[model samples]
Target: MSSFPQIPQTIADEQQLDDWLTTPSSELIEFVRTLSGDLLVLGAGGKMGPSLAVRAKRAIDAAGSPASVIAVSRFSDTTSRQWLDDRGVVTHAADLLDRNAVEAIPDAANVLYMVGTKFGTSQNPAFTWAINTVASSQVMQRFAGSRFVALSTGNVYPFVPVASGGATEDGPIGPVGEYANAALGRERVFQYFSTCNGTPVTLMRLNYAVDLRYGVLTDIGLRVFSGEPVDLRNGYLNCIWQGDANDAIIRALGTAESPHCLLNLTGQETLSVRAIANEFARLLERPVQFTGEETESALLSNSAKCCDLLGAPQISTETMIRWTADWLRQKGRLLNKPTHFEVRDGKF
Candidate 1:
């Protein structure tokens, strides 16, 4: 009997929610079995949190005992709370930044630190560092003996490769923009976890997560179908479907028993920005035109490690693009969607 709350059939329904669920896999089931106690998912209101929480419930159900799932989130509304309650997941709405607040989290034997911050506002650094870094450190310290699966981004790897391209887990973190510190926050948190043998930390360095709400595929589709101009850049990009991303992370947690493990999460194929734009144009029947000079991206990570560690994702990039386009057409967001989200120097 499956106790996992079923994820909605469509992205619109899920995103509107207080919460959503990721597709569960066999490997994920195995990982949940290894856990000795309840699985706590930090930042459970975010994109993948709901799914992870539900998956935990399913795992517990499979084990024939109700494993506790504590989902910590400040943004989750009543609907989100109800979803967790329906699935028997304990939901907590508290700021992780305060050490006192973080201390409130029951000491979980296994913790998935799924917290993150992007799109920083003017006064966001305090909250960013607090939630992204300090809170994680506090949580790690709180659950000293618990194993932690912390999320990292491929953004840590330098883009376009200055000396050489295709960054490995060892690649120097060369993130750009005012958001650079935000990128480093993951490293700092897990580094704290790495110190104690109690909390073995596994960092998942993810590339672009392909989702309809945001990411490369949707951005390109919006531009092409909306008849907008393409913004070209000089860089090789790697992406994985959001579902695949969830698979990879679940695998990481399942396999990780030692600390200081860092795996890069991305698709095997690398394509230029223009190449992807052209593909979208072909799909949308629009001309792929660019109005900007090719600027270099500072970070591009290699996913060979993840491929070898966790099985390679079965979904192809071509399929990802088609799904994203179809999703947009369904949402009716194609016409006015901006091609490239970022516009630099008066050009796309």
Candidate 2:
């Protein structure tokens, strides 16, 4: 693997953070050299997509490849579209649900499927299912021959004992809530098409990906910094730095298989909400408050297979905690999107 940029003691501003997040590692640049054609990122307007798309563009450029990075999304947030356009990534405004629009997308040898709805599942279950399942079917059919790395959620697996080190890829799946079931349906659709069309795919089951802006860490840090009582009901979780997650997802393109490879993408350690909040209290020099008790089980995933395959994430959990604490102390910009990870009822 190529050497990564040195981890900063503190990320000074959004510009610095974005630059860090989009910096492609040497391994990624090397992978892009072997990639055949342009890279298409569907649903590129979401929280993680812009950075991922930009990172791919950087990697391709660093590799001196002619492949272009194309991003497709509804782009309800015009700023996201503008951000991609400014970064030398090709931006396309389209609704994944519209079969005609999906068909109109430019062809690519590699596709990263990031389209799915999760936050408003309780209020609009049908829409969640449509975005997760229907949109997946449309994209799978439209790009039947492309090597795909589809984003999936760890929620597809039922909550396992914290001591179990999370659910493995081969374990039985028992999604608890409506959103999770729909997420599973999305995976099934990918599998079905992959079986029929022999499309190579890798389904990445990711839990919380912390970006210092919005993530499990930011959620907990905000609560601690604001003197709000931290909820510990759904105690433990698995998370990866958004940049590391993006790196793994991009690299996994090579591991795509006709049968559809299933890999859990996350940090190795099972993190504790209580411990994290207490650390935040110390960092912020504030008293910690808490409510509820830690549960024996939480939604988690074991990424041993992914680590063995892609090499372990370059960022460490300790570094994420320190960086998150500093970001909160500086009153950094937040997406204001709460992870709601404490909800155990399967509701978003």
Candidate 3:
């Protein structure tokens, strides 16, 4: 593997940001070199999927591996599909909900399952269930013979005391609200299918993944930049840099097991919203506003296991805050998708 690129003091533009996000680390390249077959990334049009797919492709290319990277999504946004194509990732337009469409998907030796609905759960919960549960069932059935690293959410685990350092993988799970329950259902579906078919699977429970464009840090930094009050109800959270998270996700193919291997994927720290907002204020030269008091518990996860298995995230939370502030200072593009990290009811 070549020498890793130096982390930029500040990302200057979207192209730079994309290039940074999709650059594979030495470890990831090593893993891809030994990867036996084609890598299929389902739901590759979402916020994190494009970068993950591109990163995998870069790794495969860097390692001079023969494996191909195929990204599947509905392609509702043609630009995302085109972006993947431009990056040398094969694109397939398909809705996983349609069994026929899934049936037509090319078979692969490994799969990164990224399909799930989260944002509109309150407004159209049935669709959320269909996408999270039904779609998961369909994909699991289709890819039963392939190894899977399916994306689950930290939301599946109920709120824990902020001082507990987040919930561990073997901890009790009590999913709240429709979206959480459905996410858990997706995991259950993977487990059921894996057990029935003897497929190796890894369920990655990720909390917040911060990219310069959108994330917990961006949400807070944007609020501070705009002079809006950052809510403190859900006081603490955990996040990993999206690049590191993507690397870890790709490397997790090694952790797949017969029934299912559950891993919480995030940074090790239990970050405080108030502290992060104040730091953003300092970096952005803006006065941060605040609303509500810190809660005793929040949706957080313990990723020590992930760090131990795949190595810790290269970027730190402090670095993420700084990058987010700098990105906002330069008027970097925002995805306009709020994480709603403050939501206690879990409606979304």
Candidate 4:
């Protein structure tokens, strides 16, 4: 495996962060070289979408492909749209929930479906279902012939024993909460379309994608730094670097199937949140607080299949923890988005 690249301790601004996140690996470039046709990334304004879109552009350029990376999103923030626009990624602003707007998007051979809602599911599950299931139905109908990679959540899997090495791709999906159930419904929608229309689709079950700005590591690091007690109920969890996740998503485009395929994507190890908190305490030179006892089972994923097929993640968890610590110490800009990984009931 290639050595993990060194992450700078202090990122000066968002552009620098974008550069770091979008820097393409040789493997990613090689993967893109095997592809032809422009790429369309739907719901490209989310946390992972911006960097993923930029990565696609960089990879296509590196592969010397004429494929343009077009990112379509509601684009509530013009800054994100401008960021993609400036980086050679075509940006389109549209409410994908609108059937007319969905029909208006230019068809592309390769499509990345990144739209879904998890937070506020309890208070507004109708909206969640609309975005996760209804919108996806329309999207599938609109792009029935295009190869698609849809981002699903690991929460769809029931809590499993910590020693089970996480849930495998073939594991039974027994989601515990409305959010997860709605996510499963989203998957079923695509599966239905894939089966009926012979549309090639790959469902990417991603748990957590970490960067310094906002993620499980950053969540714990901030809590430890603030001397707030870290909850240990959902002690064991998994995460992968956002960049590595992006690589896997793009690579999975090649694996899309008519009946749909499923791949669990996350880091290999089952991490202890308490242990991670202690590590962050050591890094921050602060005392750590603890609350709630560790549970035997937590939401986890087995990504061995993803590793075997799409290559192992390049960034190690230890490296990510250290980078996150350094980022927090240097007062790096955070997107203020929390993972809510600590929640045991899956309320968020």
Candidate 5:
């Protein structure tokens, strides 16, 4: 057993997903193609989980064979599971804090470690560390043979000076501050796991994966659509569409490189909040309004590593906003449920 750790899956529509599969970037398809044998997707029931699972199923099926895809989650969303099963995906449930569940996962060559906590998750810092930091290490220990890819946030970077371009991977990340506990503790936990076990861990430092649920799109789009004013900060927002994000994760599989890798998951362009809002308004065919107030910090990060190492490409910002806004028009809401990680600072 590695350690104690941790599904609701709801499928929106099969045809909708089918159309999404045809998307130009094909990020998800590319990622899963490199994976073979058993595939285990952590946090498989979450927002990105279902889409990623389906893409994996497609990748495995097209090659004229069967591959076991275990989608792990604590809460099993029957609808989501059924969707995956219809497309040929298996389901597993466990707590990451539990050593037994981690060990119980069928041995696989790839482990997509998507499990994580949020900005103000659990008032108890202990719970955050236990789940985000400690349990993550145990997972790496348990799946040493597997090429591991886990989602990290841009919040790990320290304050950068204004007028600087987006950060490259080489820039020093300051301690996690102004949010929950220090990011140093969380960062160290993963750093230790990667260094000690030689797990081939790829830490993906994602800026903002554009989603209807409280991401870059929802953060600025809603106010624009509702004819409300927005407060602009000097911070630049680097966003990637969630579908592209799902694809990027799959690409991390089969990365048979020496030493652990760190890649920034972000859009190629770093635009200000006001700039994004203006673009969103243009897409929605509405007039843009904004009050410019430069917030001290910018969350810009570079995606050169992903593009260079894995050919992970980003969707254009205008396209991302259009997709999100269209979905909102159809669904009449940003998220079916509230997201806990919703950011108020407009920093990504």
Candidate 6:
């Protein structure tokens, strides 16, 4: 494995966070240059969208391209809107479910669809279906002419044996719970529209994109640091750095096909929850607790095709573990969003 720049031990302020968010690689710059016209990111208020939008804008600027990066979301929290605005990413506030609102979004030659719901699925499965399935239909209808890279979850795939090195893009679509099923619907809707209108589409099945604020690594690190018991049932998993995910999402624009392309985008390694907790304990000098036993199968993905298409992730799991531990120990800012990656039943 080639070494990448290590994340700083401590991030002092929001400015540092912004710097980390927008930094791009040479590949990203070349990818952004290839994209012409405006770049629209739907569902830009989510955990990954803000940084991704900023990264796109920065990449376009670096490449000296004329394309503008526009982020569309409800912007219920003005903080996120301000964050994107400060970074020169144009922000649009609108409910994606609203047909008029979605149609009103400026036309773009390239788009990254990030709209989807995971939490509150049990209590309100209808809304989950609407957001994941219905909204996807709306976005596809609205952006039928644009080159699209839709973000789908790896939850669409069934659990596989740890020794399998995770499920590939051709894995069966047997989602475990309501949320997972709806995610499958989301992909189907996009596929349907792509086929109907002959629009180019790329369905990116992302597993876990880790960062200090919110991810499987941070979730486990914080649990270990807090001395809480980490569940081990879903022991093996895959993760990629949020920055790497963002870059791959952008680069997927070029890989879009008329009948739609499906690709798994995640880390190559199949990580163990038990081992991750121990790594966290080692880094933070804290006691770690574990409950339950490792299961034979777990939600995992094989991103070989994506890595072959795009490049391998720069940030390694070791770097992420150390960064997460130092961030927790130093009391860095947190998004307070729990990934709930340990949920074996896929409740969330």
TM-score of every candidate relative to the true structure: 0.83, 0.99, 0.98, 0.97, 0.83, 0.97
Which digits, one per residue and each the tens of the lDDT, describe model 4 over residues 1-348? 112357565555666777878988787788889887889999899999999999999989988999999999999989889989998999988898899999999879999999999888999989998999989999999999899999999999999999999999898998878899999999999999999999999999999999889999999999998889999988989999898898889889988998999999899999999999999999999999999999899999999998988888888899889888888888888888999998978788
Give the Cα RMSD of candidate 2.
0.9
Task: Put down candidate 1 lDDT per residue, 242-273, tens digits, no spaces.
Answer: 66676566557655554578888788776676
| Top-lDDT structure, candidate number | 2
Residue-wise lDDT of candidate 5 within 182-297, one digit each (tens)? 33455566667667777677777877776555476776777787787766654466778676776777776655343667778777776777777787787678777776576656
- Model 6 stretches with alpha carbons more than 4 Å out: 1-13
Q: Is candidate 5 or 6 superior in TM-score?
A: 6
TM-score of 6: 0.97
Model 3 whole-model lDDT (C-alpha atoms): 0.92
Better of 4 and 5 by TM-score: 4
lDDT of 2 by residue, 21-84 (tens): 9999999999999999999999899999999999999999999999999999999999999999
Q: How far off is residue 259 in model 4, in Å?
A: 1.2
Model 1: worst 10 consecutive residues (lDDT sum): 339-348
Worst 10 residues of 4 by lDDT: 1-10
Q: Which should have the higher lDDT, number 1 or number 5?
A: 1
Clashes of each: 6, 0, 0, 0, 26, 0
lDDT of each: 0.67, 0.93, 0.92, 0.90, 0.65, 0.88
Question: Against the true structure, what is every candidate's RMSD?
Answer: 4.8, 0.9, 1.3, 1.5, 6.6, 1.6
| lDDT at position 70, candidate 1 | 86
* Model 6 C-alpha lDDT per residue in residues 5-61, reported as the tens digit of each score: 466755666677667766877788887777779999999999999999998998899
Considering summed lDDT, which 10 consecutive residues are worst modelled in model 2?
1-10
